[model samples]
Target: MKFLHLISIIISSIFLLNPAFGQTDQWPKRTIKFVVGFGPGGANDIVARIVAEGVSKQLGQPVIVENKPGAGSVLGADFVAKSPSDGYTFFVSAGGIITNPMIKKSMPYKEGDLVPVALLAVSPSIIVVPPDSTIKNLRDLIARAKDAKGIQFSTAGTGSTPHFVAEMLKVNAGGKYDIIPYKSGSEAKVAVLSNQVDATSESSAVTIPQIQGGKLRAIASTWNKRIEALPNVPTTKEEGYPQILIGHWAGLFAPKGTPNEILDKMNKAVEAALKSSEVQKRLVPQGIEPTPGSRASFVNFLNDERNRLAPIVQRANMRDD
Candidate 1:
């Protein structure tokens, strides 16, 4: 009895010291879910699905993506934040996750509720107009916006990256435009196609097909350099509004209290997925750049993103309503 008691004590100590030892070894005995805050077909959803497939393969388990789009992705984020931190449920979050709290009056989850797992990808916004519209370029669009009535700029919703783009135009270029909120980026693009709105700044991945199909005209790529998918389209910097730089980035996050070992494993899986050539082939043509980095790197990136967008959100007086 004494020898058995000693063995039990030593085993308990080992498990306590390395909690992940048993947990991670038996982890993911079931399917994993990646919850996305935006609707399907948007850049966030697209990236999530692509990476989910890769992670599923890497982990040798089924990884599925669930879209819970609403409140600028706050709803989906809230869902993931409150989910069990048992390494099965993760959030495929976008830049909005950081900016939403800064802009909204109240958030469902607190700052530390969800922790960064990895940075997945970054997609620059493209300022686009209908193919037949008279707004041929950024210059024309800015001039039109300065008119007394002002142009109507469509966006996914309040606190969204596209909304930031509209605000950036106002703050950096003196372009006055009334914002028109839509259900999603796809709807915003359709509104532009039908001339319901004058223009919209959307993820290059979401708008590149429309531009190539000649249904929309690219005015400016809102990044430092022109997009590879649309080489002829000049960047906002080249168009003289360098301050209007922003990108819609997606990252993975797990609920707080999740084991660091699980986070590290997921991060490695994501990094491996991003490095896959097939993933690159599918992502690069759409102007989506894969950005795989360590968990700490993702945390720093989120902090920087929040710092960069906080001022813009404040200056615009962005609100959930």
Candidate 2:
């Protein structure tokens, strides 16, 4: 009896200290759900599916992509944040991942809502204008806005990164511009191309073809340096608007409370997927650079972003969602 009790205590200790003790038998027992906050056909969904494709094979399970877009991706984000942290549910988060909390005084989830699994990629935005517009470039656009009625820019909804990009530009230039919010980056780009709206900021991945096909004209990139795909374009930093910095990002996140062993496994799978030639081929050519950050590093990055943007968000008095 004494020996049996001692053995039982030892076994319990092993399970407590080590999650992988039985993971080989329990992990991925069923389909794993990969949740994306944006709709299908967009960058987030596209990246999520690509990562899922690789992870599914490695995990020996079907990794499914689920869309739950709404409230600037808060609906999906909130869902994942509150989900079981069992490593089954994951989030393909966007810029709103950090910006949303700063704008909302009573948001449902904090940075703790989800665990930063890895930084999948970083897709910088492009400052685009109407194809037929007289604004030849960033300088011309700023010059015109200096004399025109408030410029009208469109973005992927209010409280989004593009919206802030436009705001930051207008603020930096001391020019007045009213940003019109659309449902998606594609929609906003269409509005600009159709000449319905004045201008908008979008990723090179989505806007490069349009700019090349003469559908939209890219004035500048939001990053400090030019993207390889759009070698002709200059950076806002070079364009003399150093304060008007803008960048859109995407990353993988696991629901908070997920088992450490399972999270580790998932993180490894995602890292491998991002590093895979297939993923690099699909993303790099489109100018979506990868930001490969570790789970802890990403967590620290998120905290830093939240703090940096809180003051900007408050100063703008932005509440549009």
Candidate 3:
């Protein structure tokens, strides 16, 4: 009986300690978690799902997107920032990540807590109004803002891209208007459609359908070139307002301290996914131009973007909670 007990212990110890005993090199033995800083059915969610589907197939593991929307996307971002620094947990963050720290004094995690995995894509903002809005174009909106008794604008949220755009427009257009912020771009769009507000800075994804359905009218796209999706709309620069270039972007990130091999493997998967014809085709119609680059390059770009926009964001006096 004593000899049998010793043999059983040895077998149990070997099974527990030696992975090579039966396991193969399955890198992703479980599902990967892709954390999105917004709810489902939005731009962030769409991009996360598209990339996750492709990456999951490539890695032979599921890449699930968990939404954590609130406090202008800080909730989801902080979740990813505080998550274990394993390749299994990733963040599909955007300009909101860098801007959040500047807007609020106390963020859950600093920007350095996150590491870039890849630069996924970008979508520019557009100025759109309700179908029946008397303010037909950018000039008219500016004029009304300056002359009207109580002009107001709607934003996705305070410190969001649209909020910054409206703030900057207030400064450059030389007019102070009432500011109302909603929880999401869709809410802001609804406000505009209902004529509760005058204008908004929204992505093509949010505005294009409304424009097509005659619920809203897109006056200008805030990109350097006319978006292929909205060919008829002119760029803000072409319309003579370069200051209207607020845009939205999405990228891949992992919490700092992620292993190098995992990052490399994940990045390769993202690169392949972004370049896939299906993603390109679907995204192009939504005004997103697919541009994939290296992790190092993405990190450098993030730092550069942070530096370049800090002064402007500071000047806007964006802040709090």
- Please name the candidate that would achieve the greatest lDDT relative to the true structure: 1
Q: Write the per-residue lDDT of candidate 2 for residues 29-129, one digit (tens) a residue.
A: 88989888888877777677877887787788999999998778888988998987656788889878888766666677877878788877777789999
Q: What's the TM for model 2?
A: 0.89
- Cα lDDT over the full model 1: 0.89
1 or 3, greater by TM-score: 1
* Better model by TM-score: candidate 1 vs candidate 2: 1
**Against the correct fold, how does model 1 do in TM-score?**
0.92
- Residue clash pairs of candidate 2: 85-258
Off by over 4 Å in 1: 1-21
How well does each candidate superpose onto the true structure, as a TM-score? Answer: 0.92, 0.89, 0.87
- Evaluated with TM-score, which candidate comes out highest? 1
Tell me the lDDT of model 3 at 230: 82
> How would you order the candidates by TM-score, starting with the best?
1, 2, 3
Give per-model CA RMSD.
Answer: 2.5, 2.9, 5.2
